[model samples]
Target chain A: MPLGLNFTQIFLHLFNFLLLFAILYFLLYKPVKNFMVHRQEVYRKEAEETSQNLEKSEKARAEYEEKLAQADREIAGLKAKSGEEAQAHYDRQVKAAKDEAEKILRDAREEAERQKAAIVQEAQKDISDLVTDAAEKLALHQSSQENFEKFLDTVEAGRAEAKN
Target chain B: MSKKQQRKMTVIFVVIGVLLLAGIFLTAGASAQEEDIVTVIRDAVIHDTNKIALFGLEVNPGLISGLAVTGILTVFALIVRIFVIPKFTLVPGRFQMILETMVGYFSGLAEDSSPHKNRLLSAYIFAAGLYIFTGTMLELFGIQVVTTAGHSVALPAPLSDINGAIMMGCTSYLFIVVGGILNNGLGGVKGALKEFSLPISMSFRLFGALVSGAIVTELVYYYTALSYVVPVLVGVLFTCLHALIQAYVLTMLVALFYGEVSEPSEKKLRKLAAKAQKTEVRTAEAA
Candidate 1:
């Protein structure tokens, strides 16, 4: 054969290759490929699981956050409500105390005014009596010093009685 | 091992190198007349000198070399299968990483090329890559064998022989056709047959690349003036590069064509049927 191109040798080479291919397929390629594919499947499953877990955690976190936010909003609302109630209560108490204090001052002032009016009336009566005695004394004893002195004594007696 | 020790070793290596060059030149002065360059080149290209008998038939030593490589690869596969593969963990060690990288690359290529159905494609490419790569690397070892006539023959790469290249190319084409048939049926066969030149091109490509490397290396070795360090570089460059490049090329071509032929025929068939129905309706409307 030209260039030593033997058909037998070519077939032999082909057989040799086919044989090698078969051996390597089972021994080398299959095992490695199967392992790699298996590993890939495993890694893919792991990644999927990781992503699923992440999604679950994210959902849970959002739920918790929502709950926490709702609780915070409730706490804020309760705090405002309690604060308004306390203010209302304090205002009512202050108004009641102010009314009580104003009433006490008004009663005391009114009682003082009544007492002054009574004193004024009694003094006016005593003064009127003294004036009448002085007029009579002046008329009976025309310019007598003893009558004037008697009028003075009577005025001093009235003042002393009023002080007592 | 230390910096200083390394420097000393470097100096010693340099001195040895210079001495060797001087020794070679001194000794090669009155060279024994060797075989003609043309004859050597022709023999290297033809695998004529590498003759051996196998099973009562005189055979080219490329067969022996191919068998030896196949045997070595098989034993390695067995060892790795038994010991290394069993110990493979999720987190890869260096050995596991190497195995994974090689296998992973081929698997990915197959999947990308033949997405519809890639198991057979994957196996074929992986096997083909391993074989071609090992076959190419066999030349570097310069393995020798004794024939029945007591002739010692240095085994070159199998693809350096025409028969091996033809087998590889034809086999790849055969796989491509098979993939087509398996996936696309008659339509797949049509697709594969369209690229009829693929086998011839692939065969010549592999053969030319490998034989060229072998021829060039042989040529360099035949000349005393250029053989010293040039041959090693040339041999390594050609052999290793050709091994890697050719292996990738052949596998890629096979996977690409196979994928093309083996594409989901259902999708194309449906589209064609729809187009035909539309044309029929249009013709009826015109009538």
Candidate 2:
């Protein structure tokens, strides 16, 4: 064959190569390619699952933080409310005590005034009675003193009659 | 001299003496030959004519070699599929790593060329690359078979035949056409038509490169004086280089052209642009 170029050989070579290509494509290329694709899909699915898990955990963490913040706000509000209520209660207790002390002072003053008035009244009555008894005793114990006191009274009466 | 240095020097002298004696014996054997040795440059061009009658049809020796290569590849693929692939883990083993590297390289090439149709093209390119590489390197084994002329001939690389190169080139062209059609319909076919000479050029290129190596190696072996050490060096270097280079060139061309044909049509691109412009105008008016 000149230059090894034979039409028949060329045709045969083409046929043989095509056959080989077909066989290899089916037997080797297709299966290996499918395996690689399957492995890639597995890796992608794993990555997607990991990403989803991360998202869920992040969402849960955010919710927990939000709840914690709300609890703190509530605690703060409760603390302020309790403080205000305690101050009001303290003020109410102090005002009530002051009113009770003023009432007690007024009651004591009234009682003392009543007792002093009663004691003064009793002393005045005793002094009048004692003075009356002293006059009666003097009249009984001294007859001359009595006569002189009567003569003085009669003379003083006759002079009064003459002048009338 | 010290004792140790003297002993070392004696050992060196003994080795040199033995080498000189062997050289003298070789020269004597060579001079004793009665007839001068002459190397005849046999026609080492690959031929498809010698028909091995397989079920009544004349078969080419190159075709037989191609079939043998196919068989070897099949067994290797099967072994990898059955034993090697199953053992592969997320962290790859050595064999698995090699396989992955090969697949990843081809797939990456396909992706770079044709992003949309990379999946369809990667398999064919990988198959073509493996075929070319193995077929070219197959000649290195020097497997001999008796021809129809009752002469023993070394099996040649399949691509050394013009027919095999044509087939591969045409097949790649076919893939380009199909890729275009799938991506762009009739427009894709029109795009693929532009590369009608691709197959012919590709075929000749592959055939020429491989045949040239064969021819050069044959010429080297033809001279008796240059035959012994030079032929082996020439043959191995040429074969390996052709195997790697031809495989890469063909696969690269196919991927590059296939990517070109599979792109979106100009009309479609224009429509998208117009739609985007309209949206922009409407938003501007609203603002």
Which candidate leads the pack in lDDT?
A: 1
Candidate 1 per-residue lDDT over residues A27-128, each given as its tens digit: 999999889888999999999999999999999999999999999999999999999999999999999999988998898889887887788667867676
Model 2 DockQ class? incorrect
DockQ of 2: 0.23
Off by over 4 Å in 2: A82-164, B1-42, B46-60, B178-186, B219-233, B268-287
Top of the candidates by TM-score? 1
- RMSD versus native structure for model 1: 6.8
lDDT (Cα, 0-100) at A67 in candidate 1: 100
| Residue pair clashes in candidate 1 | none
Q: Write the per-residue lDDT of candidate 1 for residues B1-287, one digit (tens) a residue.
A: 89999999999999988987986787675565355678667876776654788988777777887898789999999999999998988889999999999999988998998888889998899888988889889888878788655755567788888889899999999999999998877999999999999999999898898888878877776667665777668878778888999889999999899889999777877987899999999999999
TM-score per model for chain B alone?
Answer: 0.86, 0.78
What DockQ do you compute for every candidate structure? 0.69, 0.23
lDDT of 2 by residue, A1-164 (tens): 55555666566666666666676666666666667788889999999999999999999999999999999999999999999999999999999998888888888788777876676555545544554465456557766777657645655554454334
